[model samples]
Target: MTQAKADIGVYGLGTMGSALALNLAEQGFRVAVTNRETAWIGDFVKEAGPLATALIPAETLESFVSAIKTPRTILFMIPSGAPMDAMIEAVLPLLAEGDTIIDGGNADFNDTRRRFKELSGTGAHFVGMGVSGGAKGARHGPSMMVGGTQHSWDQLRPMAEAIAAKFEDDPCVAHLGPDGAGHFVKTVHNGIEYADMQMIAEVYGLLRDGAGWDAPRIGALFEGWQEGPLSSYLIEVSAAALLTVDPETGQPMVDVIVDQAGQKGTGRWTVIEALKMGESANTIEAAVGARGWSSEKSKREIAEPLLTAGTLEAAIPSETDLEAALIAARIIAHAQGFRLLGAASEEFDWSLDMVRISEIWRAGCIIRSALLDDLATAFRDEVPHGHVILSPNIAETLAQKLPSLRRVVVAGASLGTALPALSAALAWYDSTRRGRGTTNLIQAQRDFFGAHGFARTDQDGKFNAVWPDLASEGT
Candidate 1:
C-alpha cells in the first residue's frame, strides 16, 4: 500500500487499450501500462513509439497495483463478462484504500453497479467508463461516458477530457451520472448505432431496387447526400464501400456482399430495457429485429417461393425527393432512439443531462455527426423532457419531408427489401398524428367493462361507460 498519483495505468494492451495509453502519454500524462503476457508489452511499447519509455511492464497483479500512486486509478481493458470479473477478483486484494478501478470494457451496467458496491467496502472506487469510437478514434480521441461517485468523476474528468474527441470546442466526454448511467448511455448509443446503420442500408436498398442504378451511381447519390441534411460518417463510409470494385471481377464489390447482417448483444439489451421501461423505441427495436431476421436469410429465401412478390421497378424519385425522404426518416429514427434514452434516464433516476449526451455523440462517438448538433440545440431550447418529435424545429423538419419518406417506405415494402427503421419511423409519425391507437382503445374498453374512469373525447369530463347489466345480480 504505497502512496500513488499517476494519470493512468492501462491493463490489457489490445488495440483500444494501447491507443488510449498512447493518447494519455501524448497528453503528458505519466501512464503505467501492462498486459497479462510479457511479450505483448514490447509490441505495445513499439506501437506506442515515443510513449514507450513511460510504459511499465508489470509481470504480476501485485506489481501492477503497487506501481500506481495512492488514490490510484487503474483502467481495465480486458474482455468483458467473466474474464473481467476474474480480473477484478484477482486485483481487489492488492488494491489499497481509495484506489479506483475504471472498467472501460462493454460490461453490463448491472455488473458495474454490483462491482461498485462490492469494492466500496474497501474504500475503493469503481467507475464504469463507456469508451466509444474504433481503434483510430481511440488513439486520436474517442468519446467517453463515465458513471461513479461525483468525487471520483471530478478526479478523472481532466484526464478523460484531455484524451477525448471534441466538437465546437466542447469535449466529447462527460460524467453521465452515478452507478450504471455511463454504461446505460453507452448501451443506448449502440442501439441508436444499430438503427442508424439500418436506415442507411434501407436507403441504399431503395436506390438500388427502384432505380436499377449501379453501385457507383448509388455511391455518388450518397456522396451528394453527404453534403446535405443526410450527411454522416456512416453514410460517408457506405458511399466509399459502394464505389470499391472487386479487383478480380471488376464488378461492384457491394453486389457480391452477403445480404445478412450481424450484431453483438447491446442492441438486444437496449430493446429489452426499452420494453421494461415502457418506452417507445420502435425504430431501435425494429433495427435489432431486422438484424436478427437478416441472420435467417437462408430461411427467408426458402420461404420466398411461398410468398407473393412485387416488382421494384417504380420510377426513381428525384434527388431532392430521395434526400428529403432519407433525411426525414433518419431524423425520426434518431428521435425514437433519443426518446428511449430519455425514458431510460428517467426510469433509472440517472438525472442525465441530455444536452451534454447529445453534444458528446455529435463528435467522436459512432453516432457522431453534424445532425446531432441540431438535436442538441433543439434539446437545449426546450423543456428537457419534451417529446423529441414534437419539438418545433423537428416538427417542421418532419412535416416537410414525411410524404417522400412515406413513398420510400411503400416502395421498400413492395420490393420486399427489409427497411425496419424506415417502417418504424413512418409508423411513429402516423401514431403521433393520429394519437397512439392501441392504449386508448384498451383504456376505453377497460372503462366500459369495469368502470375504470377514462377521459371523455367530447369534453374534459372523466367518465365511465358501464356494462353493469351484463354482470347481472342474478348471475
Candidate 2:
C-alpha cells in the first residue's frame, strides 16, 4: 500500500505536542502525529474535526517515521532529560541522510551540544528548539528558538515562522545559532521567568500583607499595569488569578492554594551557568531560592510558631511608586538574564543577537511584554557593549524608577514581608552602577588567607600586603 508523505511528523501527542500538531495542520501542513501510547492518536484525530483531515495519525514508531518523506522533519515534544534521549535513540535507526530532528523541550544545553556531536556523520540534522507560550501558544503560535545546521534551518524556517507568534510582521522565532544555542537561550528565559514571577509574588505580598489591600485591589493594580510598560502575559494571568474567588467557598482562590512552587530545573540551570561564567544573576538566583524556601513547608511551619510577625504598620507607598518599583525590578532582572546570555555567547561563539532575542520575546511567550518591544528597540543592531539597563533610555528610566524601588523595598522590609527578588534587583542595579565597590577588602582577605594575590586599583600589577603574618610569624 502506498502512503502519502507528511511535511512534518510530530513525535508526541501530549497537550503541547497535540497543540503543535494542530497548529501545523491549521497552517496547511500535512502533519503526521505519533505517541508511544496509540490511544492518543485516536483521541487527537477525533477531537480535531476539520484540521484532522490534514493530520495523518500513526500507531507505531515505524509507521510514524515512514509517513514523512525524504529529508524529513521530526519534532520531539517530550520531557527534557532521559526520555528525550531515549526517543532519539529509538528514532535514529529510522532516520535517513539529511533528515531533521527537532527537540521542542526545555533540555540542558550541554546535552544538546553533546547530542549534536554524537549525531554527527550520521547525516541527520539534530536541532534543539525551545518552544514557549504553553498550550494556547502551541495551538495558535509559539515563540520558537531553533538551532542547528543551516540546511535543516532552511527547510524548517518557513514552517517555523508560519507557526510562530508575530509582532507586526516579525515572527517570534529565529535561528539563534548552532546546536544547544536555542535551548541555552531558553534556559535563561526560564530563569528570568522565575525572577519575574517571584517579583510579582513579592509585590502581591506587599499589597496583601503589608499594605492591607485585598486580592481584588491587588488584582486591579495588575490590570492597570497591563496597560503600561510592565504589560506582560504573566501580569495578565496574575491579575485573573488574583481576582478569582472560589464560587464554592466565596473566598479568594489564592488564599486556599498551597504556597509551594514547583520547578523543573531550567531556572537552576540559569544560576549554575551564571556561576560558571562568573557573571552575576543574583536576582534569578534569589527567585530560585524563594521557590526552594516555599517548598520547605515543614520547616517554615515549625519556624512560624516562634517568629514574630511585624506589628508596626509601615506607611504605605503611593500606588505610582509601587508600580515604578515593579517596573524597575522587572528591568533589572531582565538585564541580569541578558548579561548572562551575553557572557555565554562569548564562550560559545553563538554571536547571539540581543535585539532579535528581544523581538522574539515580544510575543508568543510567557515573558511577552511591552517592555520587550522597548528592549528590541533599545538593543540596537550591533551587539550591546554593556548591560541593557545601562543603555541611555533604560538608564534614564532606571534613574527615575530606582528611587521608587528603594521606597518600596523599605516598605516591604519595615512590614516584614519577604522581598528577595525585589531586594536582589536593587542590589544588582546598585552594584553594577557603582564605580567603586567594597571588594578590595574581599581581595585582601583572599590574599591574606590563601596568598591568591590581588590586583591593585592604583596600579596595573597584582600585589600582596604583609598580612598580620600571624601564621607565618607563629603569633
Candidate 3:
C-alpha cells in the first residue's frame, strides 16, 4: 500500500470514471480509486495497464479519505441524483477541513450550488465540473468546465486541463465561474448538443424523404460535405454509419434500424431551466420533443397512416444544391444554439468566456468541429457577451449562406419532414435581419390587452394609442 501523497481520488469506476482515472494515473498523479464493488477497482487497474502502477484502490470512502493527504481532492464520477447525494453524505464526514470534492458528472447546477453551501461550513471546497467528450475523450482528454472559488480552481486547474481536450496546442478547459456556473454551462451545452443531433437527424430525413436517397447514397453525400463548409465530427460519424452495410443481409443498415432514441435527461433539464429563466429555447425543446416522440414509434406509425409506403419517390436535389443547403442550415442551427448558450450565461451571471468555451468545443467536446474554431476566433476578437451572430466574421458567414438555408427550410417543410431546428434557425436569421419586424405583433398584442406603450415606427420615442371609452357613465 502506497502512502497517499497529494494524490487525487476518483470515486466510481464506470466508463467515464475509469477513463479519467487512467488519464490521471498516466499523468503521474497518484490516484486512489474506490467503487461500491471492489472488483470494479481491480478491473479498472487491469484496464489501465501500465498506468496501474500509480493506482491504489480503496475498499471504502473512509479508507480512501484516510489514505489521501491534507486538502485532498476527490472526484465523483457516479450518476446524478440519489447516488451522488449518498456519496457526498458518506464522504463528507471522512474528509478533513479544506478538503475538496469535485462532482464530475451531469449534476444539476442548483444541486451543486446547494452542495457548495452545505460543504463550505465544514471548510471543504465543492466544485461543479461539466465534462464533455464521451468515453473516448475521457480516456484521451476532454474539454472540462469547472466552477468554484478562485483558490480551489487554481489548485485544480492544472489537473483539469491536463486531462482535457485541446484546440491546436491549447487546452480547451477554463475556470467557468463561481458556484454552479460550470454545470450550468454544461447543461446548456447538452441542450445545444440535443438540438445539433436533431438537426442532423432531420437532414437525414430530408435526404430519405425529399431526395428519395438510399442510406449509402446519403452517407456518401455527407462524406462529401465533410470536406466542405459542413465538415464536423457528427457529420463524419453519420456518414460512416450510413456507409455501414449489414454483413448477413447486405443492405443499407440504417433502413432497418429502430426509430427509438435515448436521452440522459440533461437536455430535458435544460429546457425546464430555460422555462424557469424565461429564456427562449424553442429549438432545444423541439429537439427533446422529437426524441420523446421517436420513442413512441409504434404508436406514431399506427396513428399516422403512411399514404405512400414504398421506397421514396421524390426527386433528389442536385449534389451542389444539397451541399449548399446543408452547410447553410448547419450554420444557422449552430448560431441559434450558441445564442441560447450566451443568453443562459448572462441569466446565470456566469461570466463565461465564450472564446475558451468555443475553443474547447472545437476539439475534445462532443460538439467539437472546425466551425467552432471560427467561433472561437470571432469571440477572441470581440467583446465578452457580444452576440455571436453579430460578430463580423459570423455575420459574413451567415450572409453568404442565408439563401441556401432558406431553400433548405422550404424544402424540408414542403416534404413534411421534421426540421424544427432548421426551421428555428431560419426564423432566427429572419428575425434578426428584419430589425423589430418580429416584435411588432407582440407589441400590438400588448396594446390590445393591457394597453402597454408601443414604440413608434417613425421615431424612437414610445407612444400609447388612446382608445374610445367603452363603458357608459354620466359625465
Best by lDDT: 2
Weakest lDDT window of 10 consecutive positions for candidate 3: 308-317
What digit string (tens of lDDT, one per residue) describes model 1 on residues 1-475?
Answer: 7333456689988989988988888888888878888788877778777776666667677777777767788899988888888988888888877778899988788888888878777877899999999888889989998999886887788899999998877899999988888988898888888888888887787778666778999898888878877778888888999999999899999888888888778888888888887777788888988888888988989998988776655555677777787788778777877777778778778888878888998878888877798888888987434677788888888899988887877777776766788889889789877854778789877877777888866799787774657556776
Residue 48, model 1: lDDT of: 70
Using alpha carbons, what is the TM-score of model 1?
0.91
Stretches of candidate 3 off by over 4 Å are 1-6, 306-316, 383-385, 446-475
TM-score of each: 0.91, 0.97, 0.90
Worst 10 residues of 2 by lDDT: 381-390
Candidate order by TM-score, decreasing, is 2, 1, 3
Give stretches of model 1 more than 4 Å off. Answer: 1-6, 310-313, 436-440, 443-475
Model 1 gets an lDDT of: 0.82
Alpha carbon lDDT of each predicted model:
0.82, 0.90, 0.79
Give Cα distance to truth, residue 118, candidate 1, Å: 2.4
